[model samples]
Target: MITTVTLNAAIDKTYVLSDFQLGKVSRIGQIHAVAGGKGINAARVLHQLGIRTLATGFVGGSNGDFILKNLDQQQISHDFVKVDDESRICLNIMNASNGESTELLEKGPLITEQQLAEFRQKIVLLGQQSRIVIFSGSIPAGLSTSVYAELIEALRKTNAAVFLDTSGDGLIHGLKAAPFFMKPNEDEIAQLTGKRPENETELVQSLHQLADSGIECASVSLGASGSMTVYKGTIYRVRVPSIEALNPVGSGDAYVAGMAAGIYQELPIEDCLRLAAACGTANALSAHAGFVKREDVDAFLKQIEIVQL
Candidate 1:
């Protein structure tokens, strides 16, 4: 089983509009409220892929209850630690007029020290049972950036592979533990390496730097163009097929889920890159957050072109 950890889970509310005018009223084209957070998304994708997954994390209050109910209805098994404070809500405003999306996010509930310890214990117990543990998204307040790093170290002893997808200090600190896999978009990778890839060769070097840091596999998303992954000192570039792109919000999360799927199956390096890039492209063809259609993924899987760098 794969265990996904969402330290700062939220109820993702998406509002779609034909066109959004500045400081003006806009009619809602559609609206969707779903269980969200990076790890939650990964779990949903894994479950859709017929993979047995257990999602564990911190949640609280009514919003938290709503998330649990939704997951339950979806038949996705989860065991989130309950806290006194309320969890957060993330709002996404997608303007179809110009194909743009703006998001407003809330810092999640401030977890208490006792709550922290309980969640930590939960993770360890769950990690012991799972073959892989996925750690993703931002942490709530009242915790240090080293939380994931510490968790990685602790879980590594259990022999379960760890994969992470997060940014900023959380990612910077977590790298010290050397996870099995990490998926950071191009900008995040540039921020960490202090170098932006101006061309394919530079990009390959940057990915190599990450793999040299001891991460078994490292990947970066290149928005619409595609993505790149490095494994065991080898770099692979995945070129995504062009399609009518709708939204790019959750594609990165989908990519992470695909990577987890590949690792769990022990797929070849090229196949791993293909699956990850295909899943991301599939997610972009829809307006939903962290979602993808199997038909799209399968069709796009054949369209992906992977080249060894």
Candidate 2:
């Protein structure tokens, strides 16, 4: 089973509009809400793909209860520690005018030291059930940036493979623990490496350097251009067939889930990357977060092109 950790969980509110206009009245076509976070999205995708997954993290207040109830209804198993402050909410505005999206996010609740300790205990207890641990999203306020790093160290004791996806100091500290893999978008990779890739070659080289930075594997997601994965000193670029794009959000999390699934199956890195591209592109053709269809993934997999860099 795969375990996912979402340090900052939120209630996701999505508004679909016919057209988003500046300083003008807008009509909402649809509204959807769900329990969401990067790790939660990954776990949801994995579960949809018939993979066993367990999600855990911090939650509190009415919003937290709502999140838990939603997860329970979805039948997605989760173990979250209760806290004092309420969890956060994220607004996803989908503009039909140009099919663009704008996101407004609230910083999550501040986790107390006692609450964090309880969370660590939960992790220790769950660590025995999962072969892989997925660490995603940002750390909440009042938590140390090294929180994931510390968790990585503890999970390492069980010989569980840990995959991380985050940015800034959280990523920096996590890297010190040397995870099994990481999937960072291009911008996050640039910020971490301090060298933006102007071209494909530069980008491939940058990914390789990340592997050298102690991570066993480093894959960079390039949105419509697909993604690139570096493994065993080799760089492979995977491309997805273009389609009528619906939304770009949650594509990265889908890709991570795909890759994690492939890794768990012991597939070749190239095939794993193909699965990742299929998952990401399938997500782009949907409206909801991590709402990619398995049929779409299967259809897109046939068109995925992979080339060695």
State each candidate's clash count.
0, 0
Highest lDDT model number: 1
TM-score of each: 0.97, 0.97
Cand. 1 Cα-lDDT: 0.89
Model 2 gets an lDDT of 0.88
lDDT of 1 by residue, 1-309 (tens): 999999999999999998988799888979999999989988988888778998889999999999999999888999999988898999899998898999999999998889889988888899989989999999899988999998998897687899989988989988889999988887789777988788888888888899888988898889888988888888888899988889888888889888888888989878878888888888888787788889988998999998886
Give the distance in Å from residue 126's predicted Cα in candidate 2 to where it truly belongs: 1.5
Which lDDT value does model 2 have at 267?
Answer: 91
